[model samples]
Target: MPTPASPQRRIGVLLVNLGTPDSPQTPDVRRYLNEFLTDGRVIDMPAAVRYPLFQGLVVPLRAPKSAKIYQQLWTERGSPLLYHGLDLQKLVQEKLGKDYVVAFGMRYQNPSIEKALDELRAAAVDRIIVLPLFPQYAAASTGSVQEKVMDIVSKWWVVPSISFISTFTDDPGFIGTFVTLGKAEMAKREYDHVVFSYHGIPERHVLKGSHNNYCKLGTCCNSYNKNNRYCYRAQCYETSRQLAAGLGLAPEQYTTSFQSRLQSRLRDPWLQPYTDEVLKEMPAKGIKNVLTFSPAFVADCLETTIEVGLEFKEMFEEAGGEHWQLVPSLNSHPQWVEGVVNMIHRN
Candidate 1:
């Protein structure tokens, strides 16, 4: 028979997300990018090639340019992703009450996964539930967090029973919350089109991570199949479908696209129509007003704020489109808080 856990055993909840640098300076951005991009799971390159390429080339060339963008997005409260993560930890703690201890960590930067694990260990938690904040599973995002969690726990003398949520891309409550917010925004403005934009990853990286043969990189993701439905691209499209259904949106009025793809060329393709490309074509398509949602990101950050919000808006405007609105992220929405609490309790 399996042994029963001690009645006094405590449970810990660790919420993780891709991190942001502490400041908007070039040095800070360089360090943050170095740590983030250098991870084997993230860049998927050999250390010999990746290390020098990142340290010597990418960081030096990209940091100054990226830092300028971060500076525009930085606020008195610091990186939006980090602060929102902190706020979520506080709110989830309150909602879950004293039964479960909740903590937050960044996969790559400050308040890191190691530090979060230490906090839980110090509290002597008997069980831990790790919830990576990526709605969709990608090796470069959630997989990296899971790898770090295992790395930390493997070193512990008394490792706790662990439960990891790989992804919640189609969680009914999560989808409902997003739909509610998007609908609310649409009600306020008469947008001619609704665009669902999700963060992009290299196509090769995604195909490399898929466990099934279904992700053939083309029309395979248009319809969800039970086998590969859990694929990141499939789930992203499913997220859009559910949200669109909830909002009573017609097929012609809404479209799904990928955004923020890094440099890569592989025979297998990524989920597309790309966001920027779509925006540039909007005016010609007779879609003047647009509403965009970044469902892949639960918290507002550079990807959503600058990439989707400002950059896409500018592109649409430049292309002669009229209103371009971005739906706010699910920062601490009540239903989202409830979802976190439920996930903790259920595990």
Candidate 2:
């Protein structure tokens, strides 16, 4: 038997998820939105442009609507995303044994990155593995978390050695986990169409991040090159392809798309076809039953629950499609929890 090391070096694993509001109330949602949207990584605009637009327009206009959606998705245990993150932390700690410490934080709101880092410091950890749960890297998601981690630790009197996993979009373990879930769902009922819908970003934002001209907002992403492979749109498409291949899905049976666009006039083109548009057109394409997955998020959130599960259901049904099922997120799934444990050790 392999014996465990004595005095095993204490290590910290910080898992970050996109944040949620403190409460479902409008005020709380407004505050959460303010912090989230104002991040330069999220909105990618100067304070002169983002602040007034957020405060004067977005907060007042969006909070109520967004709050209503949050209300529908909130549970007795609070936001699903936050609660699932907490559960994953507990499961990872159990899997890693007593030598390693695990902690979780939301990138935006309560249980902030600062608190997570402080806990790691208190544990006297010699090294830290920072894992942002965004499977696909985007300036608005994974990049924001990286920026915040550096921002917070820079002020600390003592900082531990840290490593961050920017994206695991193509991890075989991750793809395998999703394939298992997809097959289980398929067994229940074979759907006519499958949609791999990811979160959307403005076209300009993607180009600004892309180092080359390869990502021209089309099927060019179907074939990627080293220079533009890091592009968010390209990565998302590649994720869809890998997951589809893992599930043995054919090209005609599935399609890749983007969702949750805030506005139309942001000027840069976003990934397409939009989810709502797909819903309206699927019936004509003889797509009566559909399966959708939100690979962008590792845990269930307002976007996955209310937006995809509820809102998309209504749109699909209204458009004359029969069945629309959203594959549940990999929240605290045993294999997924194991994947996290493996990732921490590998890091």
Candidate 3:
């Protein structure tokens, strides 16, 4: 145990997300990106290689461009990602009530995990459920959260009983939240094809966790199984499959693609067909109007708002498509709040 305990007991929950910049300014963006990119679970390279490359090259080169995109995503309420997470925390806390205390932290920026954990500890919480707000269990997302929480809590002299909600990508309530949202959006706009766009991770990350080369990154990831249980790509496909099934979409009517890949050669073999590439090709394939879903993210942020919702929309327009609409993310919707409440109760 890392900290001495007074034996006062209570129950608590901590919600975590990928995080956002403290502001849309360049320096703040640099701080957030530097911390995010330097995580081993994210880069998966040795310090000798990762720190210099990230600090010297990646952060300096990308922070300005990223800061600009974040500026576009900023709201009167501040960062959408942070505000959404904060609201979700409040909603869940209210739902849980006197029985459980809830706090939220970001993996990289403000509302740090340490502070959230400290809140739980200060409340004398003896049992905690750590919910990483990612639907899928990618090492870079859920794994990174799990690792950071442990590294922080492991130092306490009286460590609490902690259970991490690694992934809820397949949970009915989770799938249902998106399904409900997706169906509503579809009713508003008709498109030539529906595309499920997930955040792209390097193929090597998936292969590393997949047991014994079980994932070939082909049709093998088309479904979920014990073999590809931790395979992020497979799980993304699974999310798409279940959502499509719920929306009464035929497999042929929709396609799944990866988006927001870092093109630096180090991130080679990112999950593909890339969303932008897919957009460019779809127009030529007798498809024009498009509807897109980004289930990998629960909140609408720079990636979902600008990258897919704006940038890809432009790409489709340039490719001679008439319309390209994005389904808004599951951010603090009544259904999503309910789904999260259910997850806590179940946990």
Candidate 3, residues 1-347, lDDT tens digits: the string is 68886664568999999999999999999999999999998888899999999999989999999888888989899999999999999998888787788999999988999999999999988799999999999999999889889999889999979998888879988899888887887888777899999999998898899888898889998779888888898899999999989989999999999998776535378888888888998888989888899999999899899999999998898998888988889888888888998998898
How many pairs of residues collide in each model? 0, 0, 7
Q: Name the regions of candidate 2 deviating beyond 4 angstroms.
A: 1-8, 265-268
Point out where model 1 deviates above 4 Å.
1-7, 264-270
Candidate 1 lDDT over residue span 131-244, tens digit each: 999988888888889989998899988998999998888787688888889878977878898999998777777677566666777677778767665588888888888899
List residue ranges in candidate 3 displaced over 4 A. 1-9, 264-267
Q: What range of 10 consecutive residues in model 1 has the weakest lDDT sum?
A: 262-271
User: Model 3's lDDT to the true fold?
Assistant: 0.90
Better structure of 2 and 3 per lDDT: 3
Clashing pairs in 1: none
How far out, in Å, is residue 153 in model 1?
A: 0.8
Per-model C-alpha lDDT, please? 0.87, 0.88, 0.90
The lDDT, on a scale of 0 to 1, for candidate 1 is: 0.87
> How displaced is residue 293 in candidate 3, in Å?
0.5
Model 3, position 54: C-alpha lDDT score: 95
For each candidate in turn, the TM-score is: 0.95, 0.95, 0.95
